[model samples]
Target: MPMKKKPTNICCFLPDEIVENILHRLPTKTLLKYKIVCKRWKSLISSTSFKRLHENKSLENPVLILFSRQEGKPFLTTVDLSGAVLDRWDLASIGLQNSAFLPSPFGSDNLLCLVVDMQRFFVCNPSTRRACQICLPKASMHCPSGISKASFGYVPDRNQYVIVAKFKGRRNWRMITLSRDDVVVSAGNIDERWKIIKDSARYRVADGSPWGVFADGILYWTGDADDRRCLTCFDLWEEKFFVVLLPDEIVMIQEYQDDDQWLVELNGDLHLMYKKEGQQDIELWKLDGAGDWGWSKQDMCVAGFRARFGAHFRPVMMDEKGEMLVYNGGFMEWYKLKHEVFRMGGKGYKNIHCHAEDVILDFKLHIDTLL
Candidate 1:
């Protein structure tokens, strides 16, 4: 009598631990490929274990992920800073959306973006990994006033965070706040169901640009004043508007050229990156604790920047101590320690490009590996 052949079961063949180990490293795209391998793999891939594992491994070092590469179309591949991947699957896969996008994680939370090209925004709970999309009312869409800048923030004081979309629509510069408590209706909620908090100052919406930042319960942005655009700040908690005067350095820098502004946190203080020259001569203007952005050449304490300034360049903030990381011409380069702008590390993204195919290349400090 011949022994019955053992059933060709893949799940029973490999160690459960080994399969999961391999699954953790494979990206979301590759996971889709393995779904057909066996029923067990399909189950494991969709299990909460996978999501929890990714979240745990993600907290160590921030990843530099490349997002939105078109097939053969050379779109600027965004280094997706948000922890979880955002693709066609997230909205539809989770069953909470229809061609709607969510805000990509902003600043440090590993969640940014509220969605693109659509008048929708997502409110998410990072700790629970749960999210919901909100639609505004249609009447609010035609914004008799135009949308100037939108900022979302959480205030523990009120036990509710708000999605504050600043609008300079036809009427006034109003602050539109939405919260879960504002979910008056269930399934069919309109996107414009927002209540307008009118302010005394009517901010202008120039060409419908959505550029704004939220810090310490306040929203800051660049606004037009007397035909000249300057910095503007709004307090969500206080429900008032104020202006932050540009530093002499920042003001002078803008006077001579385009008012290029970028925001980042340095040593916990919010900093405004104003570049009047190239990356090599990029000056650091102190936005807080020191003074306004107007730094004097005599105050910089650095030398040789006046003569060799190139204003056309990009800037990146890094946590890699003494290692300022930047991707130049699609290649990753690091600036040397102590020096401001000389390319140091040779580990360039020579082969990386924003191609249509799905691939992920990211970096993190090795220190967290021990965690």
Candidate 2:
């Protein structure tokens, strides 16, 4: 009699392509744990191509990432629009202890560029709990107190991450570029990585604008001079600075306090949200054509909320149904465009409680991925 055929494992019959498609759909945490399953699975999951695929899949199910600190311990919380918590991460677990601030307004490719204690710079993948320290120039390291402001962005065409920073008592801006492959920079090659950007326009960023709002491959900050009242634009690709004039209506308003206006990115377009004096409504001006200086305005009403308090709220995410998730200093609230009302702590909303002293460092929309 012939020997019985040996039993075969079902996983072995699956193609690498099929396995990859299945694996990419899983959460980053699951994939990270699955790395120990086999050498082949580990190699495939850790590849750059697989990371891109996982990130693309995550974009379809994005969530809000809130960075806050309670009693000096930093926390990163991921929640949906309904305020349901999905995952929470303690930044101290990844060696980010006593972090003075967190990356605000935006993240590139789901990767966060963080500055700790205004001195140590780090690039972190929050999903996989991977962090890399970026090397700064000697001047910056020697006098960390001089580091006034820093903005981070990704250049898609070149596949690089760029950081532009302004130093106190310095006219020229400094920049550091990190390639996708070189996520970690060593101290030995610091000089070769940092560059000094020539400021021909002599643009000065406003004092209150510490972080820039990045949109369309450009980093924008409020201009310092009152006469100018414009936006200082830094093109990442060209490494040049230019000025974009603000709308005449906003500039002409006599009671327009710099604090009343906030720059945010909505639907991939730059929007300027400004509140007029003695008005309960806010004006949202969308930048239509940067070259032609085209702008369209829409009024948003937030009833029962003071204009001063409402001015701090900025839209972080918008859904297909025209609902928005707006962030104040630390908390988040939902706004329904059709109903024109803010929703919080009710039947359809969840309340995020925090102590009076608890400080919210920053918040942004993030797609948790292996990257």
Candidate 3:
């Protein structure tokens, strides 16, 4: 006969701070399951401070979020740089079928804003399987053409999430702010939450441009005003609007003819990308300094796959090895910086093509976390 030794307790050897540091590095899915380990672990995982810590850790290895619709159901897929699937969510499981996800360059605190039936809006956290429907003002709800331009962003200073939108035939923009604690609110008395922002600058967003690119607490839109192409910037903290003029070279290029141009946030700075039709090179202009209003230009040659489809691509994210993940409105491919060639088909590349039948609604770099 032998005596069985009691199971050793982990808390006796490891401190609380060390335990939290170790848990923060775990994946969101694993952490969720570990919540049942004990009461202490469950409380630590669900705390607001812990969620913020986990979010920062996740940012180091961000993934690509593909929002698409297949068979009339919305699907969200997260993939790594190697084109490996990390996670997938059938939004219909959470009663969000046929919803359109609003596109934002920098995702809003791991939360998604979805538009349902062109009238109702919902703020959802797919990781936690929680969603809250936001009530809109009467004027905003009656738009015949629905919301033309909309963006969802987070304000770090105020710890609030804001939604900015413009409806058809509306001269001013409408906005609603939700604090972190009030993200999921009662829909009974939310009508007065929306406010109209007067457009003293009279900035009109371009017809076919994407919604908005948020960087450093500001939302920017590519548009033309006063017969000139400029950037309309809305400061979330100040609740004011300003214009940033494009470089003389870019303006000259736009004046001559129409080019495929879009705004993106790269490395926490706003970048303007444009490629002329029938050209193999794409031009990128980075805003050197927001205060100084300086611009630096770089050209990326895309002759690797131009012979086949002749499609242009935009940089979505740069990996640790300095390689770029680019998207061309249809498919995503990696551009090896050292080799200067695009990697289309390989071992990991097939994972993306597996979902080719689904209609891609939006794609962006996102950091998935427990929050």
Candidate 4:
């Protein structure tokens, strides 16, 4: 009989291209866990090409990430639009305790930029559950409390993530910028320095969390002086500040208990959401760049909302299907366009009263991926 050769290991004989194709189809969590399977798998997963492929796949299946606290522990939970839980990443592991993270955290691509303890700054990839605490510049030490306004955004021109913060003191107002590297590296290896921006606008940053909307390389925040409302624009590239007067029809309504007004970015346009003085409906105004300084009114169906929640909820977002996501007393409620309302969280979520405000503070549409 002819000599038979021993059978070779199947996985060892697998080609690199074949292995990557199989791994690409797997979910992010599985790929992350599979990295420890072997050295080869780890090396394949950590490659730049594989990361780019994974990110493209992630964009197809986007998930809403809510920043909430459970039993005094701050946790980032990923959920489907139907309110089904997919995964939960405990932020406590990264030292974010007691919901200390700021609200309306600016998210671009796959990263979240948040402020912690009102002084220190950090950029986190919630999908990968990784965070790096960045150091503030030397100027912050002398005027720690001068950080009146701050936000994070991506600058395509520089191919970098820029952090914009406005500092106010007794004498002059200063705008600072910090450029974060695109590649992820150790916190120690990164330089978190602040550079002063030369501008003369003395607009105080509005709201506690990130109340600004970042669109087209510019960070916009609503500012008020002497009951006159205006939009504060910060050019990320030019590193300059300018103010635009808001339309007379739109008014800023303040909810003493919690903030009801919001600056939302929808379909690459800036929008403002607020309730009229005596109306039971929520109003939306979109900025019309075509016209010379004007905000066009948008018609939206809030009948289903007022029927159930009675104007107590805040409109979070509107999907392509015309379904609207809103927040009510800390509970997420989904209302179809001119349809009925469904409460996302079930009855066992009574502890939500204390954390409802915090939810809106730092929540954004977060995607789950290995970034």
What digit string (tens of lDDT, one per residue) describes model 1 on residues 1-371?
99999779767778878888877664444566777888888888767767557445645433443433233221112233332332232333354332222223233333333433345565543322345565543462463333345665545466445555654343445444444343322434535546666664466433433555555565656566665555566666777666666565555443433345555433333456555554334455544523243433212322333233333222344444634444443445554435545553343334334343733222211111110
In order of TM-score, best first, we have: 2, 3, 4, 1
Best by TM-score: 2
Cα displacement (Å) at residue 344, model 4:
10
TM-score of each: 0.60, 0.83, 0.81, 0.78
Cα lDDT tens digits for candidate 3, 1-371: 99999999786677779989999998777889989888788888989899889999888777777888888888888777666777788888877786777755364475777776656678766556456776546753554356677777788767788888776666788888876455444545554688889863276778765477777777888877687888877888888778888887667663434345667777677877666555645566777655676778755544433433344455677555756677665666777755667677561243453276777667677777776
Report clash pairs, candidate 3: none
The lDDT per prediction is: 0.46, 0.70, 0.71, 0.61
lDDT per residue for candidate 4 within 1-371, as digits (tens), equals 99999877556879999998888876677788988888999999999889778777766656667777666667777665555666677677777663344323233354676666556566777666666665445543475464456767677666566667655442333343333333355535353455566544465555643435676666788776665676777767777777666667554444321244457776556777655555656567777653354787766635434446654555566667766666664566566554454544432222233334344334567656675
Prediction-by-prediction clash tally: 38, 0, 0, 4
Query: What is the number of residue pairs that collide in model 3?
Result: 0
Q: lDDT tens digits, residues 1-371, model 2?
A: 99998877545677999999999998777898888887888899989899889888888777666677877778877765566676778887777776644333344464677776666577766676565675446663444345677777778888777888876656678888776445533335533577789753387778888778777778888885557588887888889988788888778777557776788888777888776666666667887755675678854554534454454565777666767776666566777765767666452334442335546667777887776
Question: What does the lDDT read for residue 270 in candidate 1?
Answer: 49
> In candidate 4, how many Å is residue 213 off?
2.8
**Pick by TM-score: 3 or 4, better one:** 3
Give the residue spans of candidate 3 off by over 4 A. Answer: 1-22, 105-108, 139-145, 184-188, 253-259, 299-312, 319-323, 328-333, 336-339, 343-350, 353-356
For candidate 1, the lDDT comes to 0.46
